[model samples]
Target: MRTRPAGDEEGAGSSTPPAPPVSLLRSGRALLEHIGPYRWRIVLGGLLGLAGAAAAVGQPLAARALIQDLGRHDAVAGALTLLSGLVLLGAVLKALSQYVLAHAAESVVLNARSRLTTRLIRLKVRELERTEPGDLLSRVTSDTTLLRQVTTQSVVSAVTGVLTLIGVVVMMATLDPVLLWTTLAVVVLVGAVISGVLPRISRATAHAQAAVGAMGALLERTLGAIRTVKASGAEERETARVRRAAEDAWHRGVQAAKWQAVMGTAAGLSVQLSFLSVLGVGGARVASGAIEVSTLVAFLLFLFYLMEPVSQLIQAATQFHIGAAAVARLREVELLETDDAPPRPTRTRRRSPAGRPATVVFDKVVFRYRPELPDVHRGVDFEAPGGMTALVGPSGTGKSTVFALLERFYEPTSGRVLVDGRDILTLPLPELRASIGYIEQDAPALSGTLRDNLLLAAPEATEEDVHDVLVRTRLDAFVHALPAGLDTPVGHRGTRLSGGERQRVAIARALLRKPRLLLLDEATSQLDATNELALRDVVVEVARETTVLVIAHRLSTVAMADRIVVMDSGRVRATGTHEELLARDALYRKLAATQLLLPTPEGFTKAEASQG
Candidate 1:
């Protein structure tokens, strides 16, 4: 089983797969829930839309009257002038209404994307274990864009189309009841075709969007390690991998387009059939003298008007189906569990004496990343009684796992981790993590100003506290040399700074928090002899005030530890002061000789030794 850097789910002997996706209608409704806060605006837009449809309906009725008035010789010219003026006014009002609805549609998109962005940032770390950065980014960007199209264009058009359809039907009935029956028959057929085709559109769109996300994930993985690929002469291989994903996305998109084409064809067919049936029946009525020529002409015009709204309604439904598919992708990320919220402070939290440190105990801990995999920590037991304690072990001996468990990033399969006589699990996550300062082997930094990186853990830290930590960590000179000083921008992952500088920056950031227990994992691995010595002094000095736990990679870093715990094969072999352990433990002596020294012309020299 592959394990993540922190929280990792076990690959069990048996595990049930997740349930199938929710229905498109249910997913569409869930997307609409984001529009609740802007309902008033949407309602206003809808009213304007209805007014536009009302104007559209009135146009044909006026044209029918104009034709009949032209046949009459009485005040014919005057009636034509009035009719022209009314048509112009209706056109202006319709344009204004459409503008208002367009604005409301944009606002809905903004609100939804904002909420989705917030959720993405707060998601729990474990979710990252199962997710890809590129796929998550695609959902945030392109999927949200599709949702915008649905909310603004599709939903608004649907509302206006329905209103126009109703108005056209009313006019048709007034003109002739027999002709209206023919139109309703075509409407029923159109509705049935739409219902069948909409599900197909939805399924195709879902597959297409998923393929796009896969393409994004592949591209992201490649570009993130571009240098490695080039160094290993694997660029051509990686290019082919991304090309395959892109081609897959294209194929899926073509499938969706085919489904949409069928829906569009159905909509057009309904309009043509309705027009033919209306013309056939209306011609018979006029021939039998049941309605006048002018009335039959008006009924035929209304039938043509029905086509516009019906076509729009069908087009809007197609857009909605596509949007619903994208909504499902967005919901997958938005529905993920978020990190633990801040806990209320309680009196039960342990507070030790001045100049002393918090006690840490690992009690019979047994943990494996996966249930089907071998245990990383097997019935482990150890204790650190404050002061400075160094944990020495060979690589893969679970030194880093101890730090992860202490931070509560993942719970042990069984056993308890106690801090100052209190179960760490009983403490709220934020509170437990806040009490301990952890510096990983990489000492990761974000893209930001030096001041921004330093103040991340303690945003409220004052300028004096910042200067104090900088001086203690030996970063003061480096910052002072810069033109912008603390305000200087640190390039991505602090690439602008040397490895030692980056390590010191991470240490300074943690120090500003004033944690009771400090866990340093290979904190000085990147530093040169001079910088390493300076950082060692800083660690020893800090240990006087708080408990310090060091996962020692170099023996020189922990030579003065108050006590040293030597571990092998996931269990502690011995614990004592550094010198005492060196004498009593064979593993300790071997590790010290390898990590602390090298043979020189004079003898074994600690400074000139290659690091173990």
Candidate 2:
């Protein structure tokens, strides 16, 4: 799939041409703009950097003066003292500057990570489905760290290097213009070589980071399905897959290192060649009596000063290349438009009138997961009016999609989803979600204390509220049996609990929300016959006071629903009580028969009747 530039914000369904790849320079500049809030701190750090540079330049001049006054015994001690003080002060100032810059770098990384995490949480569910967790994680963590180097150390070093280079040149010119010109010629040639290779270095680094992200993606995929991998006896194969990814990353890293080493060599060569040229020419001038011997010595010292900055400049450039590559990845995340934008301000909580269940209506709803995909719901029209309704269908008939549309997780192609006559699209997302409780087929749970997961939907729920839901869901006994009760830790994805217990816990969580409408998708699929019967009774009791919509394959779970909406291929084929459907709908009859619920002369067989 082609992607547009980082700044591009075209609609997902738009027909615009794909944009050209973004340049590293552009990404680097975008990262620089993110540093705006820390401008003052950066400026303070830069000032400290300049002060250190000033000290460096002063030290060379002090050393030159001390060397020139060697014959004057009385002046020697004073010169020595001045030179020693300049060296000591420069060291102290350099240390102070580095400390401040390091602090600023850490702060930028912290802030960048916080912002990325918040944005990641608020991204559109569809966008997130298309993105890998590990790639997103790399951008959040590794990329932000690279940005820190660019913001503090790289920028400061570049500026300081330029300043020092300029100061050294001015001093060199005073000693001898001819030698200075000769030195700059060699430096300029080396710089031309560097400029030619710098862009390639960035490209190599970008490739290297991409490799690392790929490795992370592989690791995440394997670990998330580790049980499956081991169960299939494919651990060795999976290990080989991860090894391949790691090897790719290592190769890319070596390629980047190769380019960086070339840059380092060029930098060192420039300084060394300039030194030799200056020394040879300065020596000839001194021999011809055109310049003083002491001046020649000072000029060579100044040449070494020039060498330091040249080395610093190249090092800073190398860092910029690496950082620019990381910024490209980071911008890929930062540029995407989030689902939550123009954040809603806090307002008084709105409550539904008491004694009324929410009415859900689908008015000719048509939807597909993607524009290019077949429709999941084609002009589908249905309503669940303030009571217990069960949606029954064959697999892939869009039974669960009905709930998804009601929740507005994805927009219908051309239709309306209304909650109590208000279009869900018109409702504030938070309020809309708050009014409805959803439990998915898998019933995922976070790794935390049982109480933490229970209170997630309703933090302000009282002890009585928690106790009531536990008893209602028949989970009270389970919780009480635990060693730590409410504080007992649920292992990752609730591995510590049986599947049936996890389902009950999910139900209890949804109950605490006090929602006007509750959606239960395959809620009892994992339960034993006894527990299923118990939960079915609980569902019936809850539906008396609120609306309940259940998507289920088990005929027993929905045989007594107030209404059964029989669906086929994304359309509602029939709706009525179970007996009516059994008599009138062939699909319902076949489904019931498949479950061995054959009709007797009076009604269903005794065993099937008992099952229902």
Candidate 3:
């Protein structure tokens, strides 16, 4: 079994996977390009942010004028009136600007969401099986949310902050060049410190994002088997598992917080140093008659204004870390080569394919779950034409595994699986899968109306086709009892339907496909006699027109199969009729007597008595 991450400071140890870092700028550029459809909104939002920043700076300018004209009472009243108007105007513009920026950011988030979802669905089944469902969900939900934050606040603040920083710097130069140069020296030192810490902060943030993904995987695993967990009384163990993953996440978060605090405080201290340097130098220059008092006061106030931008700059930089972290997760999925699943290309819709019924042949085929291990289907050879065939085996005999290989979920490690003389590996997934209708034992029911579940197998199926299967499978009674009939909600995984009803639904779905080959795995495993009889009728109806390869369990189902192929330990052990195998194969006879044989209509009373 593949084990997920353990929540040990395990990472706190000497050897762990280095945290994913914000190490790729080219990837960042690619992200922007992919998200570029929302550029108009970003542009409009940026304009508003500039207006808001300018309005904010207007407040201090008005204050300076108010103070300068205080000695003249008439001038002071006029200055006070101007100040009130500027204040109200700035407030309104600031409010409107923030609104515009926020709304635009939301549009960016929406576009990103659509693109990610599209990418996810297009991924190959091989990858989906290899990847954890919860980790993928984290990318879709949590990482995308972080990306939204970056576009909204960080983009606007970065624009405004850079402008404000420059505006404040120019104002100081006019007051006294000597003081301005000293402040620049201090700013340079602070910038160096911030630069040194930024990579570490970004690295930690990326690890924090990955840790969230790890936690999602653990939660999904536990929740997926909640019934089994409860039955086994393993709730506390599962909880501890999740808690450990969460704690690992907490540690990564603490790493980011530590760096942020150190940088933020340093920014504040740097601003204070710049202010005191200006005040002392400007006052001495005024005393020496080299600078005017009013000008010095105005310059120091502008120096105070610079602090806002410096703080915004720091925040913008931190946002970069978060954005980089999110994009890295997104890219991990995006960069993976999609499985050979494209919707049946619209350009070619063949009225009649060259092959009528598929002739499947496996030529010395071999497969394994791991490349380093021995082959599961070791040099297997098989042939099945356009008719009914059965795969029968004991547990772990790789009967179900053969069906998986035929479906192309796993490729042969060597040799070939073929359809109509063409190697199956040569066909695109959709093209090959289109010709085969597969009914799994689980009989999965998607959350939707009954009609939706049925049509999923054949989206273009007609009403008459649906009605035929419903009646044939004895689902007509279930439909008539439900008020909404076909439109009635099935609930998640079709919990509202009984196991037999779910199996019938799967049959109805497969029936609609009009496939060249129908792959049925003991579709009636969960049903009683009455339901089993109805499904047998459905299988007989389907086998008439298509090749039916059934994985048989009960002897009743085995009796219906045209031929039986028995497998053991990944190799075919016997191929014969039920009577022939019962005489010669002791293993087959044992399996039939115990696990495979089902009581006939008359023999049921006797079989039930023998067990008692």
Candidate 4:
């Protein structure tokens, strides 16, 4: 599917570095702009890195001077004082820069983390289905975190190494142009070796991270159905599956490490080679009495300064690859447009306006799960006016499919969904959904306080409003029985509430919306005999004011409906009042005889658990 860029209001915080032209690894340098806001501070901390390198390099120069000026009283005090100050400055700057680097990298990582989180929650259902949950979680966690490490350590190292290397080259050129040329040639060779090894490191790092995401996905799916896993006794089998994925990650990490180690060793050895060349050439010049011993020592001390930064540079190069791999993984999600197309704040119905209450009309709608699967709905047409309408069909015959289309969870492949005569597709889903309340088959309530669940559709509702819903849905008794009415915790999926009670609570939530349309799919699963009658009474009363479309499994829902639309194989077989359908349709009679819900006992119907 095609997607537009995230609009200005929503699009922020996707900074990743561009490729570096001279990197040993093929991974490009991260762009300064894309280094994110946090990496900027890391760069600042790197500036102080020069001060630290100066002190270490200065020590050798000071040693050379002290020897050359031995017994020269004038040189002693000045050299010692300069050395002392350099040491002090380096120590202070080193501590400050390290703190700044760590803190700045953390802040940037946190922002990326939050952005990924918001995107995940807001992404369309279709997107979520396409991507692995485990991989997404890994991006939010492992991958983003690895990028943080690069910002703090790798980024700082690379900057400092470049500065120190420049300082060394300048000092060497001043000392002797010939020696400088020789050292630079060696630097080129070392760089070539590092370059050759880079692609392997990046590919390994990326693959390793992906393996970790795979492991996380496997665990999530298996553990999510732990009960089923145990009942089926497949624990050992699942464990082995995860172990294999983890092993793949381990192998990839080791391969990356091997390449990094080679680059590190090459950097360290290059320093020694340059140092050796300088010594041999300088010794011959000194033997001829053309160069002073003191000068050679000072330049050699400068060379040591190159060693630390060069090694750091090599390590940073490795980390650069890792961060790039991570960026590629994250870009897959970040680049997608998350904000759904703007739906109208208000609906535009397709049906022409009338004085009558709203009507939900599907005009010759066609739908298919896939191109290969024949249309589940083939130019099927039906209308549910404002009042109770029961949708009846045998299993696998599009009874539930009607609810899916009405809720706009899936649009009909062809034709239009018109509510109050306006095409629903034109309406903003959130606003459209807010106007049409849906109560699902299981009466699934989120894990939160009872009051929170009741206000799922409308949080700003008052206590009086909640109480009124309670009385109407026959939940007053449950409220009175609870230790804390409306405040009791409903465990995940309302496990704390019995099946019937859960159903009533869901109904209460729908009523709170004062919706123009209420679509219920198995909304009365938990209701016993008398409670079913009370719930049916509530639905019928609400239908008087608004449209109510129900997929009825029980006679109470059928009896309560102003009309019944019988469906079979995705087409409407007949439509009329209950008795009218019973007279005309064979399926309606069999359904009523077998599935009608009898009313509950009067006193027992009121025996509900109190809210707490």
lDDT of 3 by residue, 462-526 (tens): 68878877888788888989999999999887889888889889988887777888888878888
What order do candidates take by lDDT, descending?
A: 2, 1, 3, 4
Ranking by TM-score: 2, 1, 3, 4
Tell me the TM-score of each prediction against the true structure: 0.87, 0.91, 0.86, 0.82
CA shift at 601, candidate 1, in angstroms? 20
Regarding lDDT, does 1 or 4 come out ahead? 1
- In order, how many clashes per candidate? 1, 0, 0, 26
Residue-wise C-alpha lDDT for candidate 1, range 216-313, written one tens digit per residue: 87788777777688999989888887787788788888999998889888888888898889888888888999988889888877887788888888
- Scored by Cα lDDT, where does model 2 land? 0.80
Best by lDDT: 2
Tell me the lDDT of candidate 4: 0.73
Question: lDDT for each of the candidates?
Answer: 0.78, 0.80, 0.75, 0.73
Tell me, by TM-score, which candidate is best. Answer: 2
Candidate 1 ranges with C-alpha deviation above 4 Å? 1-22, 76-104, 153-160, 342-356, 595-612
Relative to the unseen true structure, what is the C-alpha lDDT of residue 61 in candidate 1, on a scale of 0 to 100?
77
Window of ten residues with lowest summed lDDT in model 4: 8-17
Q: Which stretches of candidate 3 lie over 4 Å from their true place?
A: 1-18, 55-66, 71-97, 344-356, 573-594, 598-612
